[model samples]
Target: MENKFRRIMRTEIHKGKRVHLFHDRLVTPTGKEVEWELIMHPGASAVIPIDEDGKIVMVRQYRNASDDYVLEIPAGVFDKPDEDPLVCAKRELEEEIGYTSEDVTFLYKFYSSIGICDEVIHIFVAKNLVLSEQNLDDDEFVTIERYTLDELVDMIFDGRLSDNKTISAIMTYKVSLERA
Candidate 1:
């Protein structure tokens, strides 16, 4: 069950607001030394907020990386290094979609990029949502959107939504619903 590679050294190449890039030297299982790039992240939490109307709350926001707007669930990185993912989820839900939930439950966790990044996304489902004021960041221009679970699945297959974490969380949420 041991699969961890031996890391000989890691040097920070650059530090950004959300991620730190490093040059890492590692020894392979075959005993060969190699250099690799790694991105260190503070991790984040996402929420699938379900309202009393049985609709899912989402947001449409512009992303600099893609130079276009993206539709995805409410999510944000931990405010503090040691902040709990659940707390982050709740805060993001209220911030991005202008709603808070009385019930939030963890669904699963996943790595964003196994090869290069140490970013882990914790997914949650929230119910009994209460309306509140949208408190987006000064730089965040977010628009609230609502959709049903079936509509999200259609968007995934139709290529309208391409955020990896969003797709993964939606699929997982659908499957969880089936099992329940």
Candidate 2:
């Protein structure tokens, strides 16, 4: 299958540090013209770093949009638009969690907000991690936490870990474990 949706025009609304907003004019399936707000992002990559003790690494950071400190898998946006998501994921695993891995594998990808944003997050699982010094960016404040896979599942059901990407990556990894 191929995408049939065609944009007639896209008018730029604003370009910020992280996202570009636009008003896109399109023709619906019913042939009606409509204008929709879209947020264009330089896609991101995330990692589920399972260390030697089988503990999954997580990051606790404050999200400005939600105005809350949230627990999530280590993730970051591409430094450039053409950057490979796998490369970004590898970098984040080291920078955010103080670990590096030679056995990184792609797990899944998804739009963070499909209806309004084009932020596709590429998720990966990194194993055989080597402990390294965390290299946090100047503006980043993150606390590292490690948990068992089952404990994370419990957190998901108990409404503790609420980040969608984290939930999705955990479940995806759990399922992968079952298959292996």
Candidate 3:
């Protein structure tokens, strides 16, 4: 067996701080050629910070792409391509929610939008958290909130928590706890 898909060519369309857009031509297994627009991301890490009382730390902020305020777990893009994802998760948890976790366990990683983008998100469950000072980015305006695990699960099912990463991380953590 051999590879069925081949990238014919790629052209960078735009380059930004966090993402780069590209136009590419590919040849399929049937020998048909097509063009696709792809977004290249540096990847990111998200953390579900569960406190001793079982409350999860979350952040609410305006998302320009969606034109709405979204509730989500603390997350941040990898500072460098070689940066450790767990380190990124820890930094984001502290920076966004003012909590530092002594126990951070990796849950899973997945692509945010496989159809058009190459953005993988590493999810982690942070336990034994201690309060710290939030250090949000200059342009970031986030409000930290804590919710019971049950409330978060309800929000996920009721459509109140719609951010993909947040939902995935929350559900994954809950399932992991059940298994343990």
Candidate 4:
């Protein structure tokens, strides 16, 4: 069987540093014309920086999309096409939580909103952290928060931790620890 959907043409409606909006014209299996609205992003990275004592570093910031301040692991988009995900992860951790790690490990990567957006989030675990000055972006309004691994697990179960990338990283770490 042939692929039903075929992109006949596309036009970029808008573009930004992190995302782009596009209008795509396509044809269905039956040769019906259709148009789709799509959002594209350079993707991002999130870090669940864990100190030597097993405390996970997080940040509380107001997300306009959520209309409230939410606690989440430090994360940022990869602005440069050639930027390493680990570097972005490290930068985010230091910028948002004021901590640098001697060892950063890639945990997992996943898409954020797969239906309409091509945003992939790379997650990392940073260990052996060194306290440092925060170099947050001018637009970033964030406060640092730390929670023990056990406390974070409880937060996940109680739904207090709602950010997608944060949840994924914590859950991955939890499972990996259990297996280890």
Candidate 5:
């Protein structure tokens, strides 16, 4: 009936392109105090772009952290905090995959990690994709890939896709389509 956790301290430890580190403390429901340590991320927007033919657009890139090439949806950091999620979604799509859509719809927004950090992710479905010259960041690296929705489902099941935000967006889009 009441909140169990209370934050006593939150201090920044490291800052990165997409993630930040935090040292924190909380008082538990049992009146016990504990240290909560984890990475803090500014959150991000992921785009599941579908073309006119219904093929889903994705990106393939080598993740330095994982030291492997991973398939993921187009995503990016929010340049302006006050900017709308949709705007970030569109910009990410163009910058990462070199595509844009006039029919982008917000799919879902959820927390990536909530236990120790306060990072939230906004996912979107962009339809009617059109090609444009890429505007990638100097440090950004990616290649575009298109897959049918069914194939994407298979990829998810086979573990070819491992990014949490991408997987969540694809599954949520499928569910939304079913509901409609």
Candidate 6:
């Protein structure tokens, strides 16, 4: 079978430190041509840091995009283009929550927003955590919190836990535990 779609051209519309915006022209299978705008991201990793007592570590920070303080799992963009996701997850856990883990398991990965952006977020569950000093970025202001798995699930159902990565990681971990 012939290829159904082709990218006629892709032009960079804007470039930022963390993202790039592109305008793409493509021909569809039906011979229809369209121009689409897409945002390219460097990808990121998040971790659900579970301490020895089974409480999950989270962070509260002010998000400029949302204009509110939001609760989320510790996450960050890849330190380098070829950095491993697991390494990024561990780094973020320590930076945001002041905990390092010896047992870090990949939970899942997904596109945070597929319609307009190509940002893939890898989530991991970090166990056997050891407390350490947080190494937050100079501009970062985060407050750490701990909650049981059940408490997090309740927050998700009650609309309190609205961050996508946090919600996904917690729910995924809960379901995986049930299956085990």
Clashes of each: 0, 0, 0, 0, 0, 0
Compared with the true structure, what per-residue lDDT tens digits does model 2 show for residues 1-180?
333667899999999998999999998776778899999999999999988898998999999978999999999999988899999999999899999998999998999999999999999999999989999999889998999999999999999999999999999889988999
Each candidate structure's TM-score, on Cα atoms with residue i matched to residue i, is: 0.96, 0.95, 0.96, 0.92, 0.91, 0.96
Model 1 pairs whose backbones collide: none
lDDT of 5 at 76: 82
Candidates 2 and 3 compared by TM-score, better number = 3
TM-score of 4: 0.92
Q: lDDT by residue for model 3 over 46-112, one digit each (tens)? A: 9988888888888999999899999999999999877899999999999998889879998999999
Model 5, TM vs. native: 0.91
lDDT for each of the candidates? Answer: 0.93, 0.93, 0.92, 0.87, 0.84, 0.91
**Residue 132 lDDT in candidate 3:** 92
Runs off by more than 4 Å, candidate 6:
1-3
lDDT ranking from best to worst?
A: 2, 1, 3, 6, 4, 5
Model 3, total clashes: 0
Winner on TM-score between 3 and 5 is 3
- Model 1 lDDT, residue 116, Cα: 94
The deviation in Å at residue 107 for candidate 1 is 0.6
Q: Name the better of 5 and 6 by TM-score.
A: 6
Clashing pairs in 2: none
The stretch of ten residues in a row with the least summed lDDT in candidate 1 is: 1-10
Question: Residues 110-160, candidate 4, lDDT per residue (tens digit)?
Answer: 889888988888988888999898998988999888899889889989989
lDDT of 5 at 42: 63
Among residues 3 or more apart in sequence or in different chains, the pairs in candidate 3 whose N, CA or C atoms overlap within 3 Å are none
**Tens digits of per-residue lDDT for model 6, 1-180:** 466788999999999988999999999888889999999998999998888888988899999999999999899999776789999998998899888887999989999999999999999989999889899999799998889999999999999999988888888889999999
TM-score of predicted structure 2: 0.95
The lDDT of model 4 is 0.87
